[model samples]
Target chain A: MGGFFKSSIGRKVAMALSAFFLMFFLIIHLTVNMTSVFSADLFNELSHFMGTNPLVQFALQPVLLFGVVFHFVLGFILEWKNKKARKVTYFKNNGAANSTWMSRNMMYSGLVILAFLVIHFADFWVHEINVKYINVEPADPTRYYHELVEKFVPIWRVVAYSVAFILLGLHLGHGFTSAFQSMGSTAGRKRALQNLGKAYAVIIPLGFIIIALYHHFNHH
Target chain B: MKLKLKIWRQKNASAKGQMVDYDVSDISEHMSFLEMMDVLNEQLISKGEDPIAFDHDCREGICGMCSMYINGEAHGPDRGITTCQLHMRMFKDGDTITIEPFRAAAFPVIKDLVVDRSAFDRIQQAGGYISVNTSGNTQDANTIPISKHAADEAMDAATCIGCGACVATCKNSSAMLFVGAKVSQYALLPQGQIEAVDRVKNMVAQMDLEGFGNCTNTGACEIECPKGISLDTIARMNRELMKAHI
Candidate 1:
């Protein structure tokens, strides 16, 4: 273990494993979210079910939170170590011209995503738990679902969601391909991974964007 | 072809350095990169100015002493060839080339393009050798029939000239490639297996101790390597380290 930690391969493995864990969470989270686009009632019912579900609330919730925290912490640690290793700085350079813009700016995009998450949770998660919205009634639980859709229907809320989804897409585009490479996939598989990465980069963001637009236009 | 060269000049290790520009005309296209520098130096001496200080011995690209960051790339624009072997044809007439020493905290510039790469020597001294001595015929070379693949890999890793191009090209100035080459050279050979575990541990420790950065597998080292040392060596070193750790 000591040798592994000291070696470059060992560190890459650690990075890959953490990334895999986070990617798994992304898939599950996106699936749960897809329901909101199809039917607000179904989405609210699922959200309420998730909130009340003992298996998820007591077990999976803690695991998910731990995964997110671990992934974010490890990513930053690796970035910090990489920064310390760099010795010289270039002036007016184009070295990163070959790489994706998102790959180069992953840390910044992650920060944006984190900011969006805080706001998202405060609007939806806080209301779900605390019944804090003006129209939400604690005694009448079904009304909470109506209030949730009403909150998302606002033009500003839709715009925020669109911007957050765009950032998330950029993050996933680089994260997915990087995770695959870290796991020892090379050459032929790398091309396939990059293609899949591009697809997810478009589909995932578009999925969320469509959901936001649908809620904003049709319901309003 | 005449070219204007803005080269960094320093009197000593502690002296402040400045970019001193020189003009050298009628240069032959066939001259090696170092030869071009030699022409510039000859001109400076004739003019009564102190010649530029640089390091080069064996000019055959085997000694790893000739190191320079030419126009941002280590050892210049050509790939897989050292500064000594690089010809002047790669540059055109009237080009202003910028030459600087390999910049790294561990590799302080001594004078001009020369740097004290002895840190590499120290890391090697840390644990790069086997304890077995060859005073008397302890064992015949034929006694250990190594596999062809391992022997080839060992030879490839041994091809590393210990040139600091990997360090110069690396954004973090990580010496992972250099250390990885040293580790791989021995790790792949049967004679090196006896001390493989201790070898990697000590070398890696010394590498960090020398204030070198960690490797990020940016592939820049491989691109800028004068000898075309593969990144696979790094992977192999990583594998050996993993086995040792486990």
Candidate 2:
């Protein structure tokens, strides 16, 4: 396992494995967030249970945090090494002639996503921690839906969250297929996986955006 | 046909290089790309200036010595052929051509257009061959049989010409495609089963030590490879490495 972390493909495998973990988190996250539209009581109950569960707080949350940091830090390292590998730039480059716009600009999209993560943590994860652990606010299950609705009601926050989700979709579009390839998938299965990845890229982010818009318009 | 040429000129590996422009006229359209370059060098030599340097041998395209980045594409704009196989007809009269050496940290330029690809040689030396028994007690050759499918796959992989184009064309300077091809050629053969474990391990270690970057699966190397080396070999090599470790 130490040997796996030291090599290049090993680092790639790390990135893929971590990215898949994050992908799994996204599905469950979107599911939980969507329940607010149908019933605020159910959403708050689920959110409170998730927030207060000892297993989640002690085990899963730390793992999720580690996954995010590992994915981004490793991504930056790979980008840095890639840049150094070519000390000199080409007089001309036709990268678009060979790859798609999303495939070529993963770094830029990733940076955008990273920035969005800071805003997200600031508004949600950090706030949740402060309310639950720091200030020792009394448990209020109803606070969950109220806070979510309040955040999206602001037009600027709505636009910011919406844009971030769209960029996340674009990132996943290339990243999904690429992660599978890195892990040794080949041939027709590779193409099928790529198509499925594209669907995942569009649908998941769109789901997040829809949840935000749904709350924004129906916050009464 | 007349054409303007912008070729890279450098004194040595340490000296800074720049693109130098020149004019070559009345050239036959049927001339090979390297032959046209020869005409340019002849013009330079006649004018008492140093001629440009590039690598080419067995100009018929099998030697893998001709490495040129023409108009930003490895081995020129054509597909599945080395620069030596590209003809002057690909360019229109009065077109300006830009020629530079293959670029990568692992492949440093030796002169004007020649790059030292000895890093590839080193990586191959690490573990590209299999050991054989010649103690006069070897197994009978007639008794050993290789499946046709495996032989065909091995033949496909054995076609890699050791050109640095895959490395040069990769945005990350990744040599995975090249290493993958070499590893698969032997891994699929029955004679190669003896040292199969160490061959991949040692080769990957050497490739990493050479300062090359990781494979991001951009698919550029596959499309740009003159030999049509597939990305499948890279996955195979990864599987080979993992299986060895296990």
DockQ for each of the predicted structures, in order? 0.34, 0.69
Model 2 docking tier (incorrect/acceptable/medium/high): medium
lDDT, candidate 1, B71-167, per-residue tens: 7778887878888988999999999888888878788878878889898999899888878767995787678999998888888888988889888
Tens-digit lDDT string for candidate 2 (A5-113): 6888788888889989999999999899889888899999999999999998889999999999999999999999988888877886667655677877788889999
In candidate 2, stretches whose alpha carbon ends up further than 4 angstroms from where it belongs are B134-142
lDDT of 1: 0.77
lDDT, each prediction: 0.77, 0.89
lDDT of 2 by residue, B120-151 (tens): 99999999997777799988756779999888
Estimate, for each residue in A110-151, the C-alpha lDDT of model 1 and write its tens digit. 888888878877876677667534555555435645665676
lDDT of 2 at B91: 95
lDDT: worst 10-residue window of model 1 chain A: A90-99
Question: Could you say which candidate leads in lDDT?
Answer: 2
